[model samples]
Target: MSKKKLLVYGSIILSMLFWSFSFVWVKIVYLIYNPITTVLLRLIISSILLFIIGKGIKKLQPIKKKDRMQLLLLAFFEPFLYFMGESFGLQLVSSTLGAVIVSTIPLFSPIAAYIFYREKIGIMGLVGILISILGVSVIIFNKNLNLIASPTGIALMFLAVAAAVGYSVVLKNMAAKYNPITLISYQNLLGIALFLPWFFLFDFHDFIYAKPNIKVWIALLELAIFASSLAFILFTYGINHIGITKTNIFINAIPVFTAIFAYFVLDEILTFQKMAGIFIVICGLFLSQAKLNFFRK
Candidate 1:
């Protein structure tokens, strides 16, 4: 691979790593603040940080008038709707399971891409997605092949999955036009606006009364800086360089990373099944990226 390809892969992998850690971070934040409060504050902080960095580096582009609605939709699908589902869902599920569920984003993304953008993934890409999803299933299901997670949590996580697919479709069109900093700055800013009403009505009183400790504060800040700000920027960079379908395939790594993080940070158990599933996921990821002629459509 060329330097450019390596950079793109590195950015996507780093983004997945940050997001995997975010599962743990969100759990820590939930010890004090509710989901709405957590989402709102992180968006506020991330937006400010991104705006300042974007301005300082002279990388932020002015939003064109025609792009306003598209950007609005992007933010709505992502930091707003996605966070709503993910934060609440994580409260009801284990961090590893939550990440595994979210990792299914790539499974649905190709259908959305084909419908909206007519983007086609070869037969190998399809097989890779199924194999990765099966790997995710291995990590989530019991020996009896029954899922062990909360039904409500699973539904909410699927809501997040849908929102992410929508976000990817919209982002594909916009990534080419704007720098990642500008795109994500606007995304979080608009997300904050969208979340304000819910935050005020539901979480504001509780947020004011609750005092988080230094550790919780640190976790929240990490979420803002790494997961919301840097991760999205890197993810946007991937979409710009690699198209929506290929970029989203990297999401499967989140479960593998999250399982490792949860084991160390949250004291979650990592059984042999989980390790095997992780290996399968990595194999699928490599298969998806391979350029073998036999695997082409």
Candidate 2:
């Protein structure tokens, strides 16, 4: 394989690993601090490290006005709305369920692309999307539970999914000018700057008063360093080289890893339905990406 292919594959694999474990880490952090405060703090740490390693801080060049606007939009769709919705959803639903639902982002992305960018939703892709959705629903709501009972949580998770889909579309459109690394890094930095006012107004007490145990602090640190910063770096690289539709497939691993984490850490038992749903979801995602659908387009 060519060097470009190697970079794409490596970036995708790292992105998958980072995201696979991130769901568990965020859930663990929420145990110590509330979602808003926890995510904000994580962002702060990530921004600081990124700034330091990015350069002496001054080495970062000034962003153009248009690109600054793009960065703000990226942050709005990603860290702002996506993380807000996800952290809130995790508070209400299990991490496994949140991971499963978020995995359906690829399904939603094509729909968004179709609507926003005049992209087509091929029959095979549609089939894959439907399969993934049903599988995720099954994984989330086994025979024992009703999906409707936690409508708020379900809605929040979908919002996160939608925000992610929106981010992908935005990135696809913006691919012409800005490098994905600049886009992702700027978004993170902008998100940190945006949260400053909120930090003083809302998270002040939580930041000062909250006493997170060692493990939760460690988890938060991992979230900032590995999951947030490193994952963004790798994902930006992969998304640029491989394209978003192709790169997103590895997100399929997230639900499975989350299930494993839930089983080991949360002591959650996996039901037959959960196992079955996982199959359905994987099938759906595969169908959604089937090459025949691309030909149909």
Candidate 3:
């Protein structure tokens, strides 16, 4: 790969790692706060930090009046619905299962692209999607073939997946008009606006009375700085450099990274089945991008 390609790929991986760690961080935050409070505070802090950064660099360009609707839609799908689904979903299911389901975003993202942009998927890519699904199934099921997660939890995680696909599709178009920092900052602000009412309605008392310790505060800072802000900037940059389909393929790594993090931090078991599943998921990720001699002239 050239230097530019390497940078793009590196940024994608960094975004994946930041997002992977967020699974752990979310669990940590829930120790003291509810989902509404967690998501609200995350967006609030990230929006403020991004505002300060944008002002420091004098890159705070106002959104075009015509583009405001599209920006709102982006926020609606992402920090709004996406976090709502993922956070509440985590409460219902194991983080491992949630990560596995969210990793399927690449599968649906390409379909969304094809629906909206008429992009075509090659045979290899479809095969890769199937293999990755099998891998995720292995991770989620035991020898008895029973799913460890509830159906409601699975549905909520899929909601997150769908919202993520929408976010990526909209984000690709928006990148033409805005840089990554401005887009993320503005979308986060819009997300805060949308979540404020819900937060106050549901989590206001929880927020006021919750006694968060130093550890929870660190997790909140990590979410605002690394996961919410920097990860989003890197993800948006990747979507701009590559298309949504290619950018989303990296999501398969999230489950792998999250599993590892859980093993070390939460003392979750890294069983043989999960290890094999992680290996297969990695293989599927590479296969999804492989172009064989069948494409030669």
Regions of candidate 2 where Cα sits further than 4 Å from its true position: 56-61, 142-145, 197-201, 293-297
- Cα lDDT of all candidates, in order? 0.86, 0.79, 0.86
For model 3, residues 146-181, the per-residue Cα lDDT tens digits are 986677877888899889989988988899789889
Best by lDDT: 1
User: What's the TM-score of each model vs. the native?
Assistant: 0.90, 0.90, 0.93
Arranged by lDDT, best first: 1, 3, 2
Task: State in Å the error of residue 33, model 2.
Answer: 0.5
Identify the superior model by lDDT, candidate 2 or candidate 3: 3
Model 2 Cα lDDT, one tens digit per residue, 1-297: 998798788888887777878888988887768777877888888888877766663435556776767768889887888988898898888777788888888777777777777676778887888778788777666466666327788799999998999888877756656654455567787777766776788778876887889999899999998888888778877777777777888888878888888889777677787778887887888788765545223
How much does each candidate deviate from the true structure in C-alpha RMSD? 2.6, 2.5, 2.5
* Model 3, position 157: C-alpha lDDT score: 87
| Candidate 1 positional error at 261, Å | 1.2
* Model 2 lDDT-worst window of ten: 53-62
TM-score-superior candidate, 1 or 3: 3
In the range 1-297, model 1's lDDT, one tens digit per residue, is 999999999999999999999999999999999999999999999999988898899998999999999999999999999998999999988898788778778767766876786666556656777787787677767889888777798789989999999998888889989999999999999999999999889988998899899999999999999999999999999989988767887887788789888989989998888788777766776566554333222
Cα lDDT of candidate 1 equals 0.86
